[model samples]
Target chain A: MNAMPAREQETHILLVEDDPADARLIEIYLEESGFGDWAIDRVQSIHEALDQLAEQDYAIVLLDLTLPDGTGPENIRRIKAEFPDQNVVVLTGFDERVFGLEAVQLGAQDFLVKGDYDENSLAKTLRFSIERQNFIRRLEETQKIARIGSWEFHPDSGRLILSDQVLYLTKPDDNEVKDDVPSAELNQLLRRIHKIALSGREINLDTRIKISGHGERYFHVQCRMTRTSTNQEIVQGILQDVTDRYQTEEMRKARDLARKSTEIREQFIASISHEMRTPMNAIMGLSNVILTGDGVQGEQKQMVQAIRDASDILLGIVNDILDFSAIQAGKIQFREEPFSLRSVCRNLEQILGTKVKDKDLGWKMHIEDQVPDQLIGDKLRMSQILFNLLGNAIKFTEKGQVGLYIELKDRNAEKVELRFRIEDTGIGIPEESQQSIFEDFNRVKYQHKTYEGTGLGLAITRQLVELQQGQIWLESHVGVGTTFYVDLGFAVEPKLTNGHVVNDVLKSSEGAFRGTILVVEDHKMNQLVARKTLERQWPEVQILMAENGQIGLDMLERHHVDLVLMDLQMPVMDGYQATSLIRRHHQARIRQLPVLAMTANAYVSQDPQLHEKGFTDFVLKPFEPEHLFARILQYAPLKAIRL
Target chain B: MSTINTQIDLEYLDSMSGGDTEMRNTLLHMLAEELPKEKDVLAEAAERGDLPAIFQASHSLKSTLAYTGNTEAIRLNEGIEASSRHGLWTAEDQEQLKVLFERMDFLLVALRDLTSE
Candidate 1:
């Protein structure tokens, strides 16, 4: 380290001139001047001067204009161009000011006549030239970092000045030097900073600086105060944006967040596996007991019923999971129409009442008189919301009463609002879990192991409620009770009671065409359910059943059928094929006969396909009685059969 | 920490309405209610066989006994369960009878309450 700063030394010089002599004048001049504490490399000829300049960093170079190898100002020009940063003074025998000026203009610091010049004047010129150059270098450096816009600030203004390259690189910009700034943001940015300064608190401001050339730049301004300023206040520190630096930081943060969520999801999957397998094992064990004890006596049948109920609950939980994913994926569609609110409420009540009794908790419902007897909306989504709320009230409360209170509020010209409040008094939701109530797969904090649920109920409820332009919220105390509220809005369409709603739908829809019915299904359970429900509706109708698409085609070719209830997935061939074939073959009224598809797969978008295949419509495999009944009245009518 | 229903007063267990007649049936009933819970505790212990855990399980059993009214049976089993809990039991396998007696008494009480309800 000779390069260790502050330890470096300036070079000393020897100016050799021999001409009566410019040599004496040069020596005297450098000795007297002491520029930047000193030094010179002087030679009469090019050869010696080259050797000395090459040896060390010469503080200054004194040249004799008249040299043997390079004569006149030619020598000055060559040396001047080469060592431009080096301090050099021109010396000549004649006062040829023009020649001296020419040498000076070519890059020499000063020029002198060999006979006329004194030591002080020559030294002054050399000293001034070096000082001016140093100042210029410092000024150029200060402008570079200050040219970039935007900065990050500390909440408290604390500055730790260090000997880092960045420290010297960063500097304030002088408005005079830079002309290409976004004039608009200057006012806003300053105002924001000033507002922050007045707050006397910590804040991180993201400033988007739109410089003229660079379209837009983002900066994080973190302001911090170290100690008491004038009035026991803190110092605010700003960390300027290095967007180039921030991109990497943002990417790192995103990866970290992704990792955390992935870990949570993995944990959720693990819990699911445990929850599913354990219950299945229980059901399997119980079923074995029931089979073994077959017709034993009083309690044995009860035990069997209990086991069946437990399995049913487990199935329902799994269904909740299916619905949760379906809703989030936007696969759950609304079947728009009119339905009776009272009947829906009664159905929900029957479902909930038995559940509360099983848990040994009280169940109560208070319906508002003003609630329109019936309203039009998506009954499926509405039922999901209602079911979730009721389930929560029952699940959380083990000892106390679980009650539902419904009231109509905010009835306006445009819409009617029906609000339902559910109150439960078992284990109240924790304060921490209040925020997480409506979030997906979020159970109450300090959760119980005994309660079984998919944890998707509340999330589905929120989504469904929003879909209907309704709202849900809750209030609770730790050991007391939690009250949950739901508000639903229905449009200003004509209202119908449950009995009338069904009657009107069926009456208007039923046509005058009695046709033979064809049912196509592969799964035994679905097929049985479909057959039983259809039989209950139309007691005396002749029926033709097919297990797959091929069989269904054969039956259609052979038999005379008015309508078909078709299952989409089958072992041999599918309903899609059967319907397509029946359409393509162009059979008589039998071919034109309405064919309704049954499917469980949520992804199969049936609207376009159903229309394309020339089928009348579709029904999901797990058929509801009313839905099946209503749609049936549309195609094969009782009146037509009578006629 | 020995949550076993020991000191079984067979007369009191037998007095329950519709309680199990055989000792094995009684033990099975108690096992149905308590064993599952104990297994859950063990799963969650994070560090098993610790003094704190044995004490905690016994404490939980004290309430379980109150609910089932099997006080005498709990007292009979308490000594060995507590000894084992303190890590002082020399012969661990020999304590099976005490565990059985406690379970039987507990089952009798549970069956009685269930029948009455």
Candidate 2:
């Protein structure tokens, strides 16, 4: 035989008795029993007993029939009332056996009359009562943990029998459950249960009830008609609380609905932008070709220039709406690269200088001595901010000077902050509308109504500045001047790198390219624009045209092509598949051919790794003459190579 | 005249057994076997003049009749159970109980006959 492992079994007892002798005798008997270890606490009054029980846990209470503060079977009732799960046994006098029996009916586990039993019997009675009470406690715990209760209904007798756990769940503090529930709701529920029972089907339902003190609660109830052993019809049911799970499912549904609506809005913006820009591409591309034509250098030149300028303004307005929608949808991501601050300033000057000169407005730019020539930041976004602000400065100013000042604010080994101040002696903004000017579509109310704008410029500028972790604000009066101050941060690149190449292509009049150019485009107007632009670039260059990528491939087999200007989104074969086939050609010379992607969708060119798609470079639609020429010159050089 | 003047409906039992005649007969035979034992318990409690015990026994028997659609017996047992609960067993309660016992005898004979068929 193996010895069993000894387990620590300690029972705590509370003896509530006013008589000191009886208390001592009870304690001695408990210690002498030798059944288990005991830690007995004695209290003389019911008040003292309750105080001790409140602070500590006891297995059972041996409550005397008489105490200093209370008497009779009432002590057992009181103990049970305070701690409903407490096990209590009444210790009565020998003549009070009738009272002990009454206390047992009330809810006590057992009763023992003093002097009527030996220590062994007394120990046995106490041990049995504790064990029985432990079983009841465990059953109640299981019921509460599962949040479930059982019920039975007899339709013919109109009698309802509820378990103790059901009474605790529905009636709570009250013992009677039948009257606590609302009569109307209970009648409705029973009607449904009866219908289901009569149809020989089990009843399963989700119901909401209002408990007087507990507010609203949800329950999932299931019941079926069952035959008793004596062949009686009874409906037995199990009800469980399902409030938490139901609410969580509802919240998840709401979140998915919100996410779906946002996706639809983004799709609408993308398609609308594409539809509006396709025609504008043809309008601007053809006008640029006509302006660089060799004949009719008089009023025809001015008319073509006006058409080009109008197309430019229309494209700007369309982009404003597209950009605003993208920003609202949180779709813009910034890029990190080393760019020349001087080059950015020079691009802005070239872009806005002609308009200012035509308006006869004085424009000056000043850079502080400590400002770095090349710093690491998002250059495209930075240039957009300057273009919008400078355009506004030239538009609002009549005759006075518009000045741009740049200064370095702070510097560490890691990063530097630069502050830009663009002051214009324009029709200054009024104090009342200055804050409102930054809101979308809010144009300043001025006496001169000739100024035309989409009024989204300042709003987009503020979002762009904040995206770069910068702040922008303006200070102005009604008539004096308006000065916009912007603070932006940039990481200092120690090793100097050449910034974005300042395109001096407009100054180069060398029509210098000698190669066969293949233009693959599906749209006829786009083909005409590309052919005319390439013909003007190199007067002596031979250009071949294809309606799609298949034709382009067939043309490539027959003709020795030097460069392929590919258009994405075609009829039979799209640019991606065509580029993949071209790169996988058997001959190395054809596989290495430079393919430039031309797209009306400006968003495509934003990706820096367009070269990975077999594209040597990318150009936006509505191509500027100089930008198109500059790209061609880079890939297909002049006949007289500058070695 | 027949001693068993009443007929009990066994539609609930038939449907519960999915119209299987053999299963229904088995259920009817079980009911026939159990009713005599429940009747003895009711009669013993009535003889002892324990109204509470009489009430409990009748309460259980009332539901048994309700399932088999023994409507008259259900009415009689309900009266006895209610009177006993109020501690007032009048002549009306005794009369209903006598009729209820007779109905129980009829139910047992009826169920036995169905099983035999």
Candidate 3:
């Protein structure tokens, strides 16, 4: 009452009492208590009290335990059942003081004994009850908005208390049995709480609970142990519903796992494909050496031709798998260099012309006058794209013609876009299967026969085209032909050079120049192949042999070596380490030695740092004999050609 | 009925009435009339398996018994009320209710003798 302030508006009180004397007494008490501005509405029963409550808002309701219509705690229960938010204080008879306390337990804010209280005490109880009820209401509202609840457990009393919001959040399904005992999930939670209490440590845990309407919900529970002022141990905690965020995180984790597995699979395939190449190099190189050597008879030469052809097909398939996996792993790097566009076309023609003539199919290539002869682009990839399309056309066609047409599509000062059309009169693709033809392992079935090639040819070609910022599409009609159109952009080379520069160098370095070439190779077959290929070309050139880079370095110290064919990926000092040693040698001649790296790894060959790593140049293994000889001719020193 | 065997404390009633003799006498008469009726209601509710009614009767009887300072009866009534509210009517609860009825009968008889005196 001392803390009570005078209200600007009248405070409304609804009194439900059956005894007229008790009602009169309470009215007098309020009047004496200086509640002049309070409006007191008196009713004879619980029903009348409820009706009055519905019609107007009241600051508080003073209920009687024994009413004519309702008695004991039932009167308080009835009023509360109607208006759960209504503040209620019960007035009990003198002997029923315990009933007053029971009334408070049954949702009444406070209780009073009829004969025991003075005006001031009565006023104080009513005012304090209203304030306490409001505070509880606000606390419940805040908890509801945050989707969070609070709980407390006393270890000594074995008592667990949950706030109203906690009760609502953890409500069980209607069909579930209701009992005073804790539920299984609640028991698990209690165990966690007990552990925290015993260890005197704070804990954060994620728990799953089955709720009334929601199937199962995730909750983030945070708990800590603390002692009251009296040193009573208690565990207090908050539970926040985090189902939405948890599910999203789980989905993201699943997606990431799927992507990681794909990467691992691709890496495995790439390594396997790479392993296949070393043996492939031996097969192809040994077969080439056999075909080029002098043979006894016609059947022997024909048998060697079959072996060479089969090896070529197997090598093609292996290369296709390697390239496809590399592209999938995002490891393909395109080189921007200046090269003659016409030269790329000439090479493609020379490579495929014999097959076309043997099949009785006509071959033609037309370059528009406006198309630049020299351009800056990945000349190797551009040649590969054209070769794949033209090769497919020639393989599929039994007769008729295969043609390549190149024309300038668009031009700016910096770059020019060239459109290429490779057309062939072959067994054309069906319209329905055209779109998926470029997908991996999609082979065209024609005349009850699958083509004898890896299905990755077109797929690799399409990926290479897109990687170069180019587009490729095809048009076909069954039994007529297939024509693939490609649009590729390249920066035009600014400098004009004599087109015969390479030929001029070749002419100057004609005939077998005398030089001591050291071949550092681990494989005996590969070393023999290199010796035979080099010795067959330059009969006067002295060739030294070493099993590894360490042996090769030792040989270089003893002899005046003109060149080193450093084979990468060897035991006891690889090509890279050997080249680094030679480049860093004390003698100027050894440091400036022309070290050409030989590798079976296409990835290593494509590395832009190959020359920067002290090697003068690199040659891909299963080497094209002419290309190997040309690279050697450029780097190997001429031993003062005998006049 | 012997008042010594009733085991009822009058101190709570005295304190509640604040030394008002008339108020104390009126409360004793009210308990004498209401105790028997509440015990009957509790037994009937249990017989019919009406848990809500049983809870109400047990709850009211517990409060009424508190005035006599009968701790045993109050505790038994509280247990019965709590179990019934959860829709549980176990054999122990039935036994407790029976004991509560006996205590109420003794309390009612003692209240009647006091009122007459």
Candidate 4:
């Protein structure tokens, strides 16, 4: 008997009853139900019963469906609704079996007749119903998480059409939803197969996908090629939606990506190591050799000096990469101070002097007389960019002259414009190379070491110029030389026009563009030529030249311009970005301005869609001066950027 | 009781299983006697395809091999199962299934030697 005392603690009983007298009687039966260590709660209303539920969670709820507070069906619905999480079994005195069926549908775990309530039936129902409900709950949870589960199987027979029959045994009803999902799976599976053959060189792949939401279904996906007397055939590809399994795996993958940043870092390091090592080693080796080549003489000394300077150039190129990365990562530091432009130019010319002399090239620096002697800027950094441009021009030119031409364009009290153009006569860069030359390490392909470089000079120049709120571009033909230009902005004299040098000259004196000027610019040369030419033409009129239709609209924003010059392609924001912006604005400015689309993009310019946009005319370059001037006269009467 | 051949008389069934009429009649008899089915074979054959009927006939033959503890027909039938990827001729697919079937047939010699003992 004492041994029974310990086992008694293991017994658990739940009594749920609503009628005061009947509830007490059930509680009595629960404690006496041949089970020890039983917990019981009794209340007259379902609400009080639910309140007791919060205090002690029962393994089961035995309830009376008929109560003064609620009756047969209402009482059962209330109990089921309030404690849906609890295991519920109905024990009612009235129409017990009738309410039992209704209660079970309402999610009550089981139903018991008043007289039928016994130790055996209650114990069996509690064990079985709880197990079943838990299984159902787990199934729903998985369906909610992965949203998909699938399986892949390779059949022993190699053709799984036979296997599909096996799966049909499990999900016998063949449906069309299954059909669509299978076709998608088959395509995905075939792609995976081709990829594996190319990547891993593995032959077979059986892939499956499972979709979620009711009618939890699964499909078997298979792929194998077979041959007949005449030809090879795709054997079987079946997609059985094994929804239950796919959910778990995809959720796991998402969790993995969320947790692993180091993996991406490692991959990035692996890809860049080969590129970084070669240049770095050269710089390191050359520096070491220079320090040790002290006793070397004559031609050797000259060669060592060449090697040393080359090493410095290499290090500078590497520094450009590091610095650009820093700028991209938002870490570039700028120091602004007043310095002499003459010294900057002198130092840059000195750096390029030897190469110019070696090539027997004559070089000249022409500065506009009115250009400021003292400039406020990062002097060393500005010199570095100018040196890169000059050195590049000198290196590329075998014969004719390379000139560094600096001229003042415009200056306000707060800002100044200095234009630098480097002209070279050498093997000219082709037109296609011109577009991407400013990109890092980009150079004309098969460019021999005759002009040795890290190929970083132009790219770094572009970056620095852009950083200084300046623009840089090059124009060249196949045999003629290339001319590189830069426009730099410096802090102005800060006096506006009141005391600024020659107030009338600073008065935006006689606008450089007048009436209507047709701007024909497909790319660098056309744009620079058009703008500079139009600026020189009127000297005091409005000037508008667009790299693409998009910029044309931008020029339209504040100016009621007299003319539009459009280039079809440059880069993004390209001609399309420009024309579309114009078309959109034209909707607002109907016939207010005339837009002339200038292009080397032969087909896009002819596209019906181009004219449907806001372009009033088209000009092709090398366009005739008379044609451009004629268009200018035609649109000169209208307000520019109107629509 | 026909002595009930504790080993069972599966040789006749196994030998006839390659769509032979005699094997079909014998498989039907085995299903009627020792095996149980909820439906008839003709309806199943009509609803499914010839390959399934053939696989069923082979599967019944496969069971007969198991019951009698025989191995040769099991080898050829397993070979037929593998070779089915390239059709019955086993002419293509790098002849992988045919090779596998041959190896399986070689493995069956062990079963045959044991049954004789």
Candidate 5:
């Protein structure tokens, strides 16, 4: 009676009974039992009961043990399965008291025996059933929303009392559940609880369990020892599923490891390449100095030329590795400046013409008349793309003609796309291998013939082309020929100017160039190479030397130098710190002085903040004599030549 | 394992209705009218080998048999209900159902005589 709804508000009841006479007897009992205020609706079978339940709310459903559609405890299960929140009081006969208890275990709130209970007992049962069912439903909803379950363990009995939520969370098969806990996961949990009870200590931990249908899941468990009102020691705890958050943390850790390994690899390659370049600079620079000097005739000159050629190939391999690393690190930069297409072609012809002639192969250079002479783009990268393609064409061809054909593909007021075709009658590439040709370190072997070069040429070429928003592809026949086509767009320089064309003038002004240059370098051979190379190019110029940046700074203080050729990676002070000092010098003249960085570190060349670091420009080491001279002539204030 | 010494016991109804003989007669008449029809259902379901229907019919009869204090019929019907629930109607279960039907038929005749009195 205490749990019953107030008389002012009518409680609706649904009676599912197949017998009309039995239903009417229950109605008369409800009225006699002081529940006349309640509205009772009757349905004959489980099917009709479900329809009525769906259409309305009921305070309680008095279900007969056997209906036409379903019978026994299964009727209660079917109804509760669909409407878990519904309060059902199983109505059984006097002889079926055992089944009435079974129905309660199967999720019925309570049960009644007909003709055995008085009106007062019937009223009390229905009222208490509704109240108990509501409490169970609230607990279920709370557990589902928070993904948490609670449990109590008794150490003496080795017994566990798990809430309905805990049973759902463990999801044990009917056979796997023993002593009210799942076998595998429960054994582990019981061990922990036993430890907690023995030590009388609270424990917080994470544990992993392999559920039957669900894969491995992680749980956050917190438990402690406590005593009941009866002084019985027990362990109580809560378990929360943290699988999603734990898996995310694991993925983040894996990604960080991958990124860290890539960084270490790039650093290793860079240091190795830097160490190799210093010695190589001495080899290439000193060799050029030897070849350019006035010396003995025929055989001696050719041997020195061979040494120069071998060193050139070695240096090319080193540069290719460094370029590939730079591309992998996403550090390659393109410069937009005014450069003549004609000059780039002329240089290519001069470099490749000798190799073509040596093979007794015909060479052809044709330019479409409509193609512009001047264009604005990254002049260095453009030249590298053309050089890589032409070099490969010459290397693959045996005796056939190597040709470069250029034409204007499309033009606008601001930009023009130029198409370059480098064709060779060589051992052509097969169609099957063409798609993967542009992948890194891929080299094609035709008839078991191996070429002597790093396999990064075409890969670097494609990267450079794509970086500049251009397209490159090829057409080839296995025995007939191979022709590579490149289509690149560039901003047109409306008027030809005096930008990179000054390089031609610098070539002619060789001995006419004069300046007092300071070379700050740590390596003895590199210092000797730099001094001799500078002196050979400009016989009248004076060259000063320093082993480190500190000495270089002192040299700048004592001498009136035109330019400082600073080498990075020195003993006392590096080039970056030395340049900072020079830029911030006490004297206005030193602060205004130009410093050209000569570095073996390829990363320094791609640094966007190079100028901000107080160096005017940088030249990569194993320096080409012509490129070194060009940088020198550009920055050094020569007293003799104004231009 | 209580034996059925009498065909009917009004002690349960007497306690519920406070010894009202009129109400007891009305309930007995209702049981007499419903028990025969339910017994027919159980027999037809057994003839057709329908286990679910047999379970339902026997389950329904056990309650009405409790009002008559027929412990033997109740026990037999419970056995039939259990076998049908397991989806099996073995030879023993069929013999039990036969005994249960005979007991119900005798109970129905006894209820008719009582209602007439």
Candidate 6:
């Protein structure tokens, strides 16, 4: 058959056939097809073909299904099971076309029937088998690199066949499931799929399996079943290790849980604040009434003063706890508005006057010349921070002094960073505990525990300062004293002519407000307090009361009220909705009329868009009479009795 | 425990009231009028497992009793307040409320008598 030679080339071919005539025909066909340089190896039986295949590398094996020693696809399966990438073209009779096609499905590259094609077709099938085998080999090489593997199970033989990659994956475990049989667990899993396959359904499963003597690992497997020509069932599928992806999913779930709990905590704290302040409004409000009531002179007046003091102490504790919780839950909102730094500090000085006197400590507040007249910032929060630091300074100082020094640290045309230094000659924190002093519920142990506080003041102060894009730190000695340094930034605002200082604003109300005022409140005691406090300031000023926003709206329509004091969290339409409605009123003057929102919630001031929420300004409950009066006078300037 | 000190602490009241007898009487009247309603709210909240309500009532009573130096009532209210703060209103909290109610009842009677005098 070697009729021609293509100079210097060698192509080996193995012809596995039992019949002499068939082999000779194949050889003649290949030679006629111009495969002249091919060195063909002829074997009569499957055993001899295997021996020859093991001995040399043949480019293609022309496999005949019928053999003297072996019969059907077993021959093809045995060779492929050993050398999975080996190329084989099945040779069969016309009557055995089905078996030949089955052999191809079992990993043979292509199939051909005797007398079905010419020499050209024979040569084309052979060349195509080699090319297809090379493509499969390269694909398997890539899959192996990506840690993916393939597998097959023959139910008739109860044999599990694994790819090279599958073998490599199990290599780490050194696990051998006894003579190529799957473990009981794996067999049970296969049986389940076998049941599904009975109905011709496919199975896809992602599960974590623990191999004997090996740790747990996750796998994603997709599989289906098919039957051979002999009706023998075979299961084939792919398995991928997905342990890393599984772990990532678990971590993501954990993060979501943490975020959900944080939100719940924030909501809990907000509700608690509301609950606590509602009653505080009653206690403080009634006590103020009793303090101002007639027929209470001498000892009775002193008793009312005591009640007021105790109420103040209780209020302070509640405020501290709420502030700390709010800060911890990241719920503190900050507002930016035009406020004078000088006025804020001076107001703080006056508010802390009684504590300074009670502690018998001298107090000094110094404002640098370079400090801006007005800055756009959360005035209430800025004042709160100063108030907390100064309050603490006063509380700890016994006889020496507490001082606050404010100066411009750095400034630009757009913003200014001011440094607030509050120093006190009082019991100081130790060197080691200084760093952790700002932690929640942490307090330096005093010898006698004489000081009264919730120990949350400093922690809340630090959080508020940080929320404002500022920083706070402290230095202290055990016995000598303590000094806290805070740096905060504020946007510069155009200075208003004759900027109002605390003294001038509080003390210089242009006589009693003589215009009509509307008081919208839900609580009876608070309404009484507002009425009495307003009357105490201006006895002739006409007053109107509304229990809620709905009533408030009705009152505004009927009365010539100059100002509306709106409460935020009231029954049957709250202050926010009422204020919005009022702003949208059909009457231009009524819509433009100022609404001063009065909220028991201190957090209201933290809302950056308070003005947008339809409020001229807001005053917190348990209001200082002077502060409330000033806020009122700002809206309803004093006038001759209503025309 | 036998003689439960239910009387108002004169020293705390003296300091708080600046020794104003009429102010002390006014405070006593307020306490007498409010304490029963506050106690009933706490009891009902505990029975209904309304922890926020229990927490609110306990806090209100605790702040009010702090003015009178009713140590037992204040301590029990603090316990209830703390328990309910975490939304855990249990049988033990109800028992503590009972004890608080007893002590507050005794003090309320004393205050009423003082007001009449």
| Residue pairs clashing, model 3 | none
lDDT of 1 by residue, A313-406 (tens): 7656755765675575455666554666665665666556667888898878777878776576766577768788888778777798988788
Best by DockQ: 6
Per-residue lDDT of A1-643 in model 6, one digit per residue for the tens? 2222223466678888878888889878987998557877788888887787777788888889998888789889877766566788888898999989779767888899998978999888887877777887887788666767787778776666666565554443654322333555555665676667656788788876666566666778788888878888888877777777888888898988888887767666655565555545545655565566564677777766777777778777877877776776667777666765765565566567767887778888888988876788878788778888888887777779999998999999899999999999998877988888888877777776746777788888899899888999998998899999999999996643212222223322334677888888765445655786777657787889997889999989988888789877565777888988988889976786768888766577566445666687787776666567656654443342232
User: TM-score of every model?
Assistant: 0.42, 0.57, 0.66, 0.34, 0.64, 0.66
In TM-score terms, candidate 2 sits at 0.57
How much is the lDDT of residue A470 in candidate 2? 99
Candidate 4 on A294-355: residue-level lDDT in tens?
Answer: 44466655654555465456545544554454444444444455555764565455556667
User: How well does each candidate reproduce the native contacts, as fnat?
Assistant: 0.00, 0.00, 0.00, 0.00, 0.00, 0.05
Using Cα atoms, each model's DockQ against the true complex is 0.01, 0.00, 0.00, 0.00, 0.00, 0.08
* Models ranked on lDDT: 5, 3, 6, 2, 1, 4
DockQ score of candidate 4?
A: 0.00
All candidates' chain B TM-scores are 0.41, 0.84, 0.89, 0.31, 0.88, 0.85
Query: Of 1 and 4, which scores higher on DockQ?
Result: 1
- Tens digits of per-residue lDDT, candidate 1, B23-109, equal 224433553456446535523531354545544444344323432435453443354345545666434523533463556545656
Best of the two (4, 5) by TM-score: 5
Give model 2's TM-score for chain A to 2 decimal places: 0.65
For all candidates, what are the clash counts?
42, 0, 0, 33, 0, 10
Residue pairs of candidate 2 with colliding backbone atoms: none
Scoring the B chain of model 5 against the true B chain gives a TM-score of 0.88
lDDT of 1 at A199: 72
Docking class of 3: incorrect
Query: DockQ of candidate 1?
Result: 0.01
| Lowest lDDT block of 10, candidate 1 chain A | A160-169
Residue B70, candidate 3: alpha-carbon lDDT: 74
Model 2 chain A lDDT-worst window of ten: A497-506
